[model samples]
Structures are given as C-alpha cells and as structure tokens.
Target: MDRAEFLNRLEAQLLDVPQAEREEALQYYEDYLNDAGDAGDFDILQELGTPEEVADSIRNGLRQDSSAAGERSGQADEN
Candidate 1:
C-alpha cells in the first residue's frame, strides 16, 4: 500500500491507544516514511510491513521496555 493508505490504516488501528502514545507512534512512522521518501524510496511500506504489524511490533517493544524498567526499579528498591 501507499503512504496515505498505510498511515490511514495505522491511525485507525491506533484509535484505542492513548492520545499521547498514539501521536508519538504516528510521528515516528511519519518521519520514518518521510525520510525514506526523501531518500528516493517511495515504496517503504513493503520494507516496513503493514501498519497493523508495525503497531504490534511497537506495542511489544513498549511492553518489553516497561517490564524491564519495572524489574530494574524493583531491584533498586532492594538496595
């Protein structure tokens, strides 16, 4: 799919996400796409995967990071 279509799909998928997090994710992908387009590669979606897949990857990363942070904090509390 094209950039607009991919972004539209991503936005729709993000409808249930918290506003701040949603905007951050959207901006990250928008910048990523824009940079790719600027570098003369317009069909970046193929390389990036579908919006749903991208969102799932991002959410997974967020969950992992949060869990790691919690573990770190818990260890700190034992000091």
Candidate 2:
C-alpha cells in the first residue's frame, strides 16, 4: 500500500492503544518511510509486512503483557 493508505490503516488498527503509544508507533513508521524514501528503497513496504499483520502482532504483544502482569499480580497476592 502507499503511504497515505498505510497510515490510515495503521491509525484505525491502533485505536485501542493509548494515544501517546499510538503516536510513537506512527512516528516510528513515519521515520522508517522517510528513511526508505531517501535511500531509494521502494520495496521497504514488502519487508515491513502488511498493516493487518503488523496490527495483529501488536495486539498479541499486548495480550502477552497483560497475561504476564496478571501472573505477577497473582504471585504477589500469594506472597
């Protein structure tokens, strides 16, 4: 997808994340695009993967963090 389409899809998927975190993610992607653009790397999109895939990865990471936090809380309760 092109830059505009990529950003639009990314913003939609990031709706559930905190604003600051979402902005940080967006900024990182934006910088990646800029660097790729300067380096004549039009195929960077292929390496980054699809927006849906990236979003799913982010969601999975969040789920893992939540599960870990819950486990830690349970251990604290037992202590």
**Residue-by-residue lDDT tens digits, candidate 1, 1-79:** 6787888899888787778888999998888888776554455777788889988887787789889999999999999
Worst 10 residues of 1 by lDDT: 37-46
Off by over 4 Å in 1: 38-42
Candidate 1: count the clashes: 0
Error of 2 at 5 (Å): 2.3
TM-score of 1: 0.84
Best of the candidates, TM-score: 1
Which candidate tops lDDT?
Answer: 1
Worst 10 residues of 2 by lDDT: 38-47
lDDT of each: 0.83, 0.80
